[model samples]
Target chain A: MNPILKRLGFRPDDRVVIIHADDLGMCQATIPAVAELFDAGLVSSAATMVPCAWFPAVAAYARATPSADIGVHATLTSEWDAYRWGPLSTRDPASGLLDDEGYFHRTTPAVQERARPDAVAAELHDQINRALAHGIDVTHLDSHMGSAFAPHFLPAYLAAAAHARVPPLVPRLSEERMRAVGMPEEMIAFARNIVPQLEAQGVVMVDHLIGMPLDRHEDRVETAKQLLGSLAPGLTYVIIHPAIDTPELRAIAGDWRARVADYQAFCSAELRAWVQDQGIHVIGWRPIRDVLRGA
Target chain B: MNPILKRLGFRPDDRVVIIHADDLGMCQATIPAVAELFDAGLVSSAATMVPCAWFPAVAAYARATPSADIGVHATLTSEWDAYRWGPLSTRDPASGLLDDEGYFHRTTPAVQERARPDAVAAELHDQINRALAHGIDVTHLDSHMGSAFAPHFLPAYLAAAAHARVPPLVPRLSEERMRAVGMPEEMIAFARNIVPQLEAQGVVMVDHLIGMPLDRHEDRVETAKQLLGSLAPGLTYVIIHPAIDTPELRAIAGDWRARVADYQAFCSAELRAWVQDQGIHVIGWRPIRDVLRGA
Candidate 1:
């Protein structure tokens, strides 16, 4: 029996998974696609980019639909070439959360190299606060582009989640696996120390995290099916970025085809039937939020 | 005697001017600059770009300061190279509100050639409605890059303002002057006929519209002083784009120096004293809104 499943009151053999969408408020295309997935009950959870231009639309949707399992996608990077957003806390040149162009750094490496820990902490809190202020009953917190997963920012991220009383999307990876994924030795050391502490404090950490290859653009439905078949027992988190095919999406994302494919794959009856046949016990962050809140 | 002055209970000879800031919510730079101007009572009114990424900050400011004279800057163009925004109503490629890159057309000419009239109307209404939804108590509407002032869009623009019961920033330009500024014959003909109708409906139009030369990067204070010295007795509208000097502003605007100069010019004690000496009666859009609302 997986201890997380036991904690969540699941049976010994239960295979719980969270089919989650990423970047729900990134653009107009994302909103409709996420809404469709939620309405169809295909995706169990999603997160929003608090700093994006289309975020107000997400806030409005959250206000109208209180049951949607939405979280704050703690954004620390603005990667698009023609569309950019900056830190909500401060735009000072010395803030260290900003690149030379005054937007968030475009890549995780740039963020890891340049972002000051205090600024990172402040920005993460601001993102969560802004989401809450906009009436989102935020269920969890997750990092965009994995920027907050860097060792220097991990403490701030955890503190922010603790402050907000929401479970963070933390995966229980071994130190070796973390290193294989390019996590620094500092992060591995910190994770080794903090994982158990968080688990002791009743934060739910997934047994595994899975995502599709970013370069795979074709046969996404087949890819998704294969991924589902390969899922192991215990709790797992699957992250998918799905967006409707629109000019705006194409303009902002070079991986528009892959995103569109994800949207189609998740929304298709074929995939839904496959998941049911696989007997995956789909769950959302609500239970984790409840646990964190001592409900 | 200026009929607008009589309507507003001002003497005919009073040199009423609106020292207005354009692009209030366009970025962080604009917000603080506009706030400082408003706090110091240098600028009389400012308009917000509802589609811009930083617009929620403006809404927050408006909510905190109920007396702030804020209006919707009906945005139909996203002109910057690295920072762009799209129409609020739709992101459909075929909607004709988007350019090849899926943003609002970068220039007024591009918008005029590409945007559908119905799409333009819907987007303008959506922008205003979005601002109102954000609790703006919107006082007026004006065109960004004058996209809404084009002949084909004029009817929709006026209709949006009428629907919202807020005055649209319409200037009383002579037919020859409009032609001189490259207004198409159709626009001149349309303005000639519609201006009278709008006035008869109690819509106030400024007698003269003045903006500093776009190319003037230096001596902005001197230029502003000279412009103030040349003000006519009839109601004149002075438009300024003021932004704090920051890396973000520099990245988004080619005329950042001029914008910063405008901020400095307006915030200067010298300029404030000069305006006082000139006895220019500064006004904002709130009174116009009241009149349009039959208050």
Candidate 2:
């Protein structure tokens, strides 16, 4: 059981949760949809990618809705081919973070290959400070494409969350503990080396997380119900990419249908009623952030 | 001799010239290089592609520079593969103006094949009006990739110039007249039917032109000097695309060096002295625009 949730006055066994949507500022079409979800309380929170084309709109929303639970999805990768973005931090000309066309490389591996930790730290700070400059009192700090999870970026990631005094998107279990809790040993072993120092930063890591094996969600609503039904003791986080299906979205991302499914499953009245009936406590990053701030 | 130039108060045999740099707002790097030419009184006029990525800077420049001669490069083609632009006018989902990928087609023939004249006109008005709305007092209008030279588009091209009460970038000679001035027979014959109607609009056109066989200019300065030396006794429109050579420009356009050469030749003191020594009166679209407005 997570001690952090108990420390925040939740029962040791309470299934505290945060349903977060990623990539709010990726495109114009996602704005209204996410805003509607935020208005209806269909989702717990969302993070914005500051380097995206539609970021100003999201930033304006953050200013307008000061209480909205928003974070900078600290971006260091530019994924799409025709539609691309570059790094916020100026890396060396030889930095592996940038691609041949002078855009950030698309994947975690590409970024990890040449991304200096100091450069990564600078970019993370840039993104966070940009949100702050735009009057966004960001609720928490998270990673984009899980780039922060890379071994090279782990210290910077933990340091950033500590620096910001906000809860990070790290899972509750340590790498060895994650293996004990059924996370693949291959994944956990790499993280095991950094676990002690990351824990030493006094960051609040989540107890359990269930959004992995994204391929398991062939029937997203069914999967959501099962995941909700099987929630373990203490806090768990579900990281989802929720977006309305539009022509532009389909053209932009190959896995866009999954995003639409996330929106549908999360926003559905059925899902809401199911969560309520199952006695699940719907929460957000705000309380977790407050606790981290106090810590 | 240019009767239009004479009507506009120029001498009958005056070799009036407009050193016009097209695509002023095509990129961020081109602005400074083009502005330097304008400040040096090397380029008499420049035109901006309002549909381009860097239009706002050029628009801001136009607002700040009331005396600067700038015009709209009405565009309907999305030429470059990686760096493409879309039409201002959002047509119906089935509008032929849009390619399968939901952008403007890549060439004039593609636009001509499926383009509705009304759609073309709407897009032209949108581009022109966007410049106006951005506070650009457009001095003239011209084709991009010579899309207006296509037979189907010529009417809308001429009508837009008249509608805007601005000079259209057509040579003073008709296709047949171009041949009489030593242009190719086929080129003149292709333009014969519409030439008279285009002329009847009372729109200002250049008496003769240079910048032909743009591929022929390996030594751009030599080309410019010879073209100025052999200028016929009438207005000559020297159409050139100028840019500063950078990695971005090189990646975007293969003929970047030629564009840089155009910038170099036009901005050189030698070319200014050459034009002055030969007594070619430097003019711009403003006087012609006034002539059209008065007519």
Candidate 3:
């Protein structure tokens, strides 16, 4: 049994789920939709990208609603062309995180290949510290585009979460667990070996992670229903990007409609009803953080 | 004879004018209006607020149009309630430039009371270097909200400009000039003695300066026509804040219509024709830099 979940006092067979929205402060579209889902108690948690243009809005909300189960979505990539942001810390420009254009590179592979581990650590520390300073009682931590999932970044990522006394969304891995998801053999072996080292440091991770396949789906409602119905009996994080389609979002993101669809699906009353009908126990990161850090 | 204008090979009675647009990158509204005036050759030069949201747009334009006379508007004020920005250098938060809300103070008095002179110099240096790194052949430096005009900041302001080999917008002050303008007795006395010390350092200063009343005017065309006609027979800077009256600007600034009026006046064919008729030889800071730096 997972120690973090055991501390939360959930049995091994009990089905617990965290409907988590990603990219809370990326643009004009994301925050409002996430707020709506959060308000309705449909999505119990969200991760905020603090360096984006809409961060002040999230900070405003965080200040107003201090108990919101918001995590720092530690960002390294500026992915979109028209909408780009730079690092928060001007303390270190030689951090290898910035390209020649002085913006962060748009890909995880580039971050892995080009960025120094200490620089990566510095940026991550800056992001988390920025949120905490913004008055966010950050419940957990996660990565944008899996940038921290790279082997080189894993230690820094884990250390940052530990330093902040927050749970990270790095799942407890095993060969069976990785192979169950059809991960590459080498990665499965690597992740399996690394999981225990992280677990030993009192890191909190979901028992199983799900809902990535439902992303950018042709039929979001149907896919969302399928995702909700198929929730296995254990703690799982079902990730989604919820955003209302606005002209600003359209200009900023190419996948604006996908975001709109995700927003619609998550905000759907049917999805809420289906969770209850399926007897799935919905949870947030607050309890997990309490269990991990309090221990 | 005007010493600075004389350095530029202008006669004593040349009546040189720089139709200088202020706040080129302060918001979404300002850029397009400034760009149009620059394109039509109505405005000879424009200062850019590097901390503002629209800076990247102007930087892109400066890159594409290499000959544009872009000067960094050394900003210490974030003025408006809704639209706010902070410093470029994160190295010194203890510098006291940031207000309680983490934005720059909205007034020069606040800056004088709070900001460290060294930090002001660092911020100004960083802004210019950021522009240069963005491929802007930055022509000069100027202060936003006259922040650098405070007696406490004047030395750092001039030092930064001199260090960059770029001229600042400090006019050479004299008692007669100060008394003529109805300035305070104390300031006039201080400025009378200080001007010669600055001139001794080979610091380039404008012989005459105008452009205060035209802001927020109901009839900008009439005001502009009058301003050009009354220009002294020396180098003078006519500052204006031009912007298309967009909803964002309307929401951000109460003086949006005045900005629109400014945009209209500078882009107006009648104004351009009037300047030509008045024999005001319109020039930019590029020539001033040429004379001042001899580079």
Candidate 4:
């Protein structure tokens, strides 16, 4: 175990990390923010969404730097009114997965109702192959919009992750573990039922995951402090989405105010100072991979 | 349950669909893919990685077309070697998460050893703010490199995710669950156990997840077939990183071979035909959101 794990109260590093960035090949602002976050000490790893057109640019960057920690942002859905892509598996009109244009239908339900596992897997493989073709040294995998997790799609999801040998960012918990971690009963029962099924398929899982702070501008500092004070000694993950607001964004976004607020919080200096004051050890995905592998 | 869910399940009229594009701001390839996908009816929703350098290009596109399903790609790590970025958090030497050039360390371990949760959370929020400030809609939130799931940083991850009220793509499971899913017993769990916590916090977790296909070129087809044959019942998410290779990419990527292979697989007509023959369905995120929210 690493020395830091012990200090955090783990027995010779009982903890793990999965420092991840969302939407790798998503948009212009995201590319730099994710790259910069990774470049700086704020994050440890990031992933790329294949279907998005910007993926090549991201892939080129990844190719240029082979050692960068990258993962496949497995994409099953194409989002954006004006911009979208079809499944790597071309659509069949009969499947209804695609619209009149033959591209993917604009939502998960459409895919769920019309998409087939065969199509999903094909597109999935195609996306990965595309990344490899572009020279990306992907280390892990994740979902683009959680479409794979919707009802009736779990089986294919596990098979794909196992086939890839790439560690999945999400974990499926069991009832006992959920209880130990203080989860609600319904969740525990739900976990108990699902855990065994997921394990049977060779899927990996995690103990706990956390989300990042989402406070308004006024509450940013206090929220950060409170969250820091509540830190526990266990492998946990927090998720956040930050972006620099632009007029173009406001027009497209249903709620741009919240997004702007999040960006401000990310750029805040006070939060950084507070983290130092609290001595909370921040980490990312590489350690988590190591810890998991070591275990 | 949302009305969309009923239609998706074949118990109602009108098949609901959500064709979401996985990546938008990732790179030049992704941008075109998304645009083409949308144009071709292949996808409907998309997001952006605000921190990425190529964001300007994506932002320009979003500005011109306000209907895209654009969201913030919350960034945390800079995994690439030559390409890296720093956290929005105030630069701190103690964090030790910085790279040689003072950007976030390229590897996850380096960031884990030194990053501060408070700082991490702050930076995450700041990135969101940046997205909003730019005119990005940021419909939802997700991780770039799984930065939010870092072992020591999970608490901060949760705090940030919860604060945002946006859904995060967490798929945690317990060790025992993996056993049920056929995963090796010795493997440490990371994502499963956190399901309850995420659910309790009202954070959205994908039901299932998958990864990109790796290793052999010919094996890609069989892998896709296997993936299709064994899909489980749920919203299964499969991740992939696809990009068009170029001289620029060759200069950057150490694993140029893999990138090339991935691209080949993605563009293969055989795979697309196989998917069509298999009757697989495809969808996107917006439809899923509608189903979940009953919108």
Q: Name the top lDDT candidate.
A: 1
Write down the worst ten-residue block by lDDT for model 3 chain A: A208-217
Model 1, C-alpha of A22: deviation from truth (Å): 14
- Predicted candidate 2 versus true structure: per-residue lDDT over A239-270, tens digit per residue: 87777766446545777777778877787888
Q: Of the candidates numbered 1 and 2, which has the greater lDDT value?
A: 1
A188-259 in candidate 4: lDDT tens per residue? 566567766754654455555554543444565465466556755455554555444543343334444544
DockQ of every predicted complex? 0.04, 0.03, 0.18, 0.01
User: Which 10-residue window in model 4 chain B sums to the lowest lDDT?
Assistant: B10-19
Top-DockQ structure, candidate number = 3
Question: On lDDT, who's better, 2 or 4?
Answer: 2
For the second chain, the TM-scores of the candidates in order are 0.96, 0.90, 0.93, 0.74
Tell me the spans in candidate 4 whose CA falls farther than 4 Å from its real position: A1-19, A94-96, A99-106, A172-191, A196-203, A212-232, A255-257, A260-264, A267-273, A276-281, A287-295, B1-295
> Candidate 2: which stretches are off by over 4 Å?
A1-295, B91-93, B173-190, B212-218
Off by over 4 Å in 1: A1-295
Maximum-TM-score candidate: 3
lDDT of 1 by residue, A1-295 (tens): 6555786899866788899999988766788899899987879999999877667678788899998999999999988764567676655556687776446799999988888899889888878987898889999999998889887788899999989988888888877778888887877888898888878876677888888666777999899988878888888889999988765566467899889998988999888888898898899998878865675
iRMSD values, candidates in order: 15.7, 17.4, 3.7, 16.7
**RMSD of each predicted structure:** 18.2, 20.0, 5.0, 25.6
How do the residues B1-295 of candidate 1 rate in per-residue lDDT, one tens digit apiece? 6566778888877888999999997866788899899988879999999878677678888988999999999999988754567776665566688876456788999998888999899889878987888788899999999999887898899999989988899999988789888888988888899888878877778898888766676988899989988988888889999988765566557889889999988999889888998899898999878865775
